[model samples]
Target: MNDYNYVVIGSGPSVFRFLPGMQGSKQRILVVEANDFGGICPNAGCEPKIFFEGASKISLLSQKLTGRGMANPAKIN
Candidate 1:
């Protein structure tokens, strides 16, 4: 059977940071990624959140520029 001294499962920024330390080391290191690298922050959650927030900001800005008056302004109803 194949043997390795270290196996890192997730492919996130932390993994990238840790990779340099493993270089030139005697221990065999293996990185196992089941999906896209860079993890959920870049591939799913955080990035999408940022994108949606930016879109909302742009929509608000456009409404303000056109003097449309807050499109769904908080009504406290």
Candidate 2:
């Protein structure tokens, strides 16, 4: 049987940041996550929302500047 000194639950952003420091240490660590790692922010949540919002804003701005002396306006793909 394997014994761990530290058991981390949920691989969120904070966990990601915290785990690196634990590396190369003698302590045994185990990470338990039931779903895709990286938590909500990077997995179908805040990050995607922010990215799409930025894209939307840029697309709108491009449309507005299309005929106002700007060439090759930004495109979201």
Candidate 3:
């Protein structure tokens, strides 16, 4: 059960950059990875979801600049 003409299961990064162009090309390639391998946009969807969406857009711009008072409501932690 080790016969493989080509079994790229996927480890992302375009399967290690197209698997060295299928080496010699004679066949028998098997890269089966279940996890932890540059998949899902570098392990879990794009840089921690863009750092929690930039901290929820700076906590909604500091709650809209403290409700237009021009910034003084700092407690978003």
Candidate achieving the largest lDDT: 2
Q: Which stretches of candidate 1 lie over 4 Å from their true place?
A: 48-77
Error of 1 at 66 (Å): 39
Candidate 3 has which clashing residue pairs, if any? Answer: none
Task: List, residue by residue over 1-77, the lDDT tens digit for candidate 3.
Answer: 68997788878888888888887887788888888876888777688668877888877787788858755754446
> For model 1, how does the per-residue alpha-carbon lDDT over 45-68 read when each residue is reduced to its tens digit?
686668777878876676666645
Please, what are the lDDT tens digits per residue for candidate 2 over residues 1-77? 89999899998888888888887998888889898888877786786778899999988898889879778688887
Native-to-model Cα distance after best TM-score fit, residue 73 in candidate 1, in Å: 26
**Over all chains combined, what TM-score does candidate 3 have?**
0.34
Winning model by TM-score? 2
Q: Between candidates 2 and 3, which one is better according to TM-score?
A: 2
Per-model TM values vs. the true structure:
0.49, 0.54, 0.34
Count of backbone collisions in candidate 2: 0
